[model samples]
Target chain A: MIQLIAYLIIIVLTIIFLIKMIPRKLKKSPPYTCGEPMKFEKPETVFYRTLSNILGLKKLQKLSTGNLNDYLLMIFICFMLLLIVLVMV
Target chain B: MLAPYAVPLLICTAFALPVFKNEKLIKAIAILAIFLSLSFVLSSSIEVFNSGTKVFAVSGFKAPFGIVMVLDKFSSTVASLILFLSLMIAAFSSKLVKERVKEFYTLLLLGIVGSLGIVITGDIFNMFVFTEIMNIATYALIGFTAKKEGLEASFKYLIIGSVSAVLMLLAISLLYSHVGTLNMADIISRIDTNDIYLKTIFIMLILSFCVKIAVFPFYVWKPDVISGSLEPVAAFFIGVMTTTTVYVIIRIFYTILGIYYSTWFSIIAIVTMIVGSFLALLQKDIKRILAYGSISQLGYIFLAFSTGLAFQGMYHLVNNAIIEVLLFLSIGTMLMHKKMMEKISMYAFLLGALSLIGIPPLSAFFSKFFIITGLLEKNLFIYAIISGLISIVTLLYYMKIYFMLKQGEKKIYWPIIILIIAVLLLSFVPVWLQIFKGVEVDLLARNEYVSEVLRP
Candidate 1:
């Protein structure tokens, strides 16, 4: 029991020391980018755009433009392709 | 018997709605009428589940001669779901829709009629008629605001819907000429699966339904349509309209055509999942993100369907519908009452978003688990993996919406709260009801469906 109490005391002291060691004040500095501040992009934009490029989704996205004629053309092309595949199968 | 009556009741209520000028009276009557319609559907669905399939033949004429409504396990369940969502929409819209209250409820009921008719009707040509009715009503509802964007979206949808209708009628006529009958059961027995013309008809029919259901290349209209409309109307379109069209596709492919598997269909489903997720990742608008999310979710359903996992597909469909309605309505509530009940509204939206992401202790997770297991059973390891990865992407996009929520509330709490409870209860369905196994068996029992409709 004495040993256990001693260990608990040690754990509490360690946690207190760690908490006190954290800097309460710090110097602020602008990020260095060859003496020019970097332009910031939304994390969502960066992550998704990078992923989208990797997946070649730009072409698909391009086709999804809200133009009615584009939608019709794409539907027609897909329909014809489906018909061909069905006939072959 | 009660199933067929829902359409007329809704139509009658729709016609009667315009006569009343008082907004409160209009809202009361609309809610009462939809409540009645829901009760009728619920009772008939219970009858189907308890006894067996019920056939309601019009004018005492039998199959292959006159129109009939077949209330089998599948159709009854889907019909019940459609009406239930309509009721929730009616209740939610009562508080949100103040301007043109009469016209709004009237169009809403009319849309319900179209969807209910599509689900219950057992004739192929009747299905075509109901599809058109649903399409016209949907176009009007999308343009209900009469805003520039809304009108443009409505016009685009109208054009696409018209072309699809033409394709559907052409296919149906060709089918009738070939089979000499419009009754689904009769046609099922008469169809020669090997015929070339039958293949053409199948492709054409699928293309038409694809437009309605908003499959991959055809899904461009949905986000625009959803973004342009009022939030509750968008909820109705996303939750009720798209799902009803999916039910039609399932009925046609499984019951009528007897097609249980197709490689090309599964490929299209996978592509739809990939494209929808990628596009959703790119969207900044909350509604558009949800619109694309629904498209991705539908792909999951189609994947399950194409892989012979109809039960799992349907389970997911129910989960997706509830989640979508909850999310859309919560957002609508937040926007309408910005200061009143922001805390509860935010929590509701968070719960809905989590459910959509398929987090554990939520309904979608179980349905998605079933679907993945089903794919594994069929040795579709790649498709299973893809679906799992897409869920992660789903989480990412949903987080975007979560980050966007500001605050809001009031009066619409009951509907959203009821929906939240429904979503929670659905996770326990397999444990409590033990109904899914029976439903799965019934779906595979194509011969039973045919016999029920044809029995004199």
Candidate 2:
């Protein structure tokens, strides 16, 4: 019983701590890499500029696609989870 | 009983560690504690090997009425690996960990103890408890540096890990509902009798374990978290913790679930191999690249194990553990030099990279060869070919790192040389083969292990 209460307290504290730490607003400006200053008008523009700086967007035009990699990874994980559930059911 | 001593000893030593304010004294105590644990692990492992299997019923209760610790070949192997890697990391961290030495060692020891419990425990509920202990220690250790990246990585790992834990707990509850017992062997014996819920529980348990082992699609957090943490801790996890998880999964699959219902295992192994290698090729960061490489390597180990050749798979496990330790130690050595380890040092890193990539005459090549052979023996020809091809892709990424390190300015260091020699010796001498042979054939086969655990 005591162990259960301690676990609950820890869980509540951790959740509160995480909620407090989440950033309130997304910064809209040029993407920062290693604290190097850059100029960009919009967040979307910053994405392209950052990509060009990191992986050379001009050279990557042939391989670039509208689909985001992070989205694809998320989709993959979701599919796996779904498969696991289906198998269990 | 000796079974429970492992956890209390580790916890007591961890608590005592912070009392020593002096760095030197703390290091001495940490080393002493770790060495003592290692000796205990060795003796216990030998006992298990000699005795076929031994079970320790906790608190004077019998079988399903109490928690039990089971020491068999699988658990003993994992325990030995954990202790061996802990010893190596402690030696490496003696010089590496600068600030909060006591806290670091405490967390490290705690992590080891938790993982050891996970490996040995026969009770499913105890497994969950041990998993939580291991997870908390890991989260704290990852944030030990207190840097922005470290904190961010730890938070990410913690969130994902918690979700995984919940999934596991739900599965365990479902199993308990069906079986009315938490003891693994007891549960296994009764599992086949339940026709309606058997498949559901099996799938849930397997998925939960896959998440823990970082197989295929569930492996996303591993690279970021491992790469962002302290090098010694990262190395220890890669060398020991992940492998132990894999061992537990294998134990559950074969000993608990029985290998007759293992059709999904082969499919998962193949997918993990292909996807892991593909992603590894795209990574640029040195540590992240190694992390992905480990994922790919583990996929091969899984493939080997699922092919019904347990001993051969066990061989790969030992080999992989040795190689990972050598590679990570070398990388850590490089990072400790004059310049902070960054995007540079690509040239000197080639040896370790090439070996990992399975270039001939290195340790990885032989292990990969045996895995393929095991697959072929099982008539898994397509998988054997796929495994071979993925290994080729692994070589390409390894070369990518090699070329990058090559382009960096060359600087000779004594630690790098010593690390290189160590890697070479491990790969060339084949010390593990002799050690395992001696243990399994001469000592363990005699059933001394069971007697030790069953002894009054």
Candidate 3:
């Protein structure tokens, strides 16, 4: 019963997130792969940087925090995943 | 004994790789090892065709307990294809790529071994082991360039692949608790199909395979990874990795999962096809375009296999791999020039592009024809219509690529000519044969496969 409630809460939050992330104006070009290199900032969390180094992913973790479109797309993808989990769970 | 040597020899050579510092000698050794393994696979596959399924239990342990390798029509067909393609890639790499050659070949060989293991293993745990091997090799190889792009792509792929692997391992562990075995055939024979947990496990496994094969939703990493890798690496990933993953999906489809959930599979394929086409249409980079094309092609394989036309699916799988490898190699040669493709390279690219577009007399067209026929036979009119529309979409993008090219003269033509003739001959042969032999001798021959492994 606890697990069921937890799953429901996760689903509701995910749906809310997806709905918020969807842009009103659909852009003709995606913000990703604009042939420019991404510059990521230092991680605010110690845990994230530590984990990153351990996994040899410190290099990739430097995604540009400034790209609005990538942010939305990433969140949008997260929502889709959460929706899938809703079905699976 | 001979058929199973490919995987072990590859693994051993990979371990021995770091010891060598002379890059040229390392490359020569890599080529020689790949050639010898290819020869072994060829001989074993021929033997299997002439007689029956062959099994090699690792370290002499019996089935339901030991790691087992299978050499039958299904595995040999895909394995030999993987090897032959790898050999081509070895030759291609030896000529072009020079820096970090040692580490690159090691990863390449490891990736090949992992792919071979997927098709040849009889144990589920062994499959998981090989999956890790493949994923790690791929992660390292993609980032091999150490440029920000390559590192970024490899990192994304690593995160996604690791999550999927964890999910798969969890499902497998749960399954072992229920069934007390990890051998695929052993588990299949003992599976409680109606069990709720079993169904969940099945879904988890499918999800994992989805990530590997770059199906919709989970395919986010494919474009970056493909676009950022070196030419030969891209060819191996696009050609061999996709084929092996689809082969495993087909194997799992037959041996474990029943047809009760096929609708979901078809729906996934349809969405994948539509999404792949739209995104592929949008891509500007050559490698990313080819990557999206691979994703779209995988949908056709799934659609045909979903409709129970396994033979047609296998036909497309093999055909697509060969076509894509030749295309990449030809394009690699062209890209070696600063601004324009030479005449010979242009024609070679045109052959692959025309084949990809399903132009008549090309191999891709016949496979697509058989798939459409299968869908129509099932009265899936909507699906058939959508498929026809997608074929036009495919042609549109390929034509876009052709229009984008500017020509200059270059010197690589013979390898592509050999590949083209092979594709043409394969496409042209056996049009009148009524019954398709299918990939059953290795894939569907579960009883023979199981018994052979279980035998002393």
lDDT leader: 1
TM-scores across all candidates?
0.91, 0.77, 0.82
lDDT of 1: 0.81
What is candidate 2's lDDT per residue for B92-168, written digit by digit as tens?
77778897888888888888888888887878899889889988998999988899878877887787778778878
**Where does candidate 1 chain B have its weakest 10-residue lDDT segment?**
B429-438
> Candidates 2 and 3: which is better by DockQ?
2
Deviation from native of the Cα of residue A80 in model 3, angstroms: 8.9
Docking class of 1: incorrect
Quote model 1's TM-score for chain B. Answer: 0.97
Residue-level lDDT tens digits of model 1 in B249-330: 8887888777889898899899889888878877778889989988999999999999899788888888889888988888
Error of 2 at A58 (Å): 15
Cα error of candidate 2 at position A69, Å: 14
Give lDDT for model 2.
0.68
> Where does model 3 sit among the CAPRI classes?
incorrect
- Fraction of native Cα contacts kept in each candidate? 0.47, 0.06, 0.00
List pairs with backbone clashes in candidate 3: B342-B408
By the DockQ metric, which is better: model 1 or model 2? 1
- The TM-score, computed over Cα atoms with residue i paired to residue i, of candidate 2 is 0.77
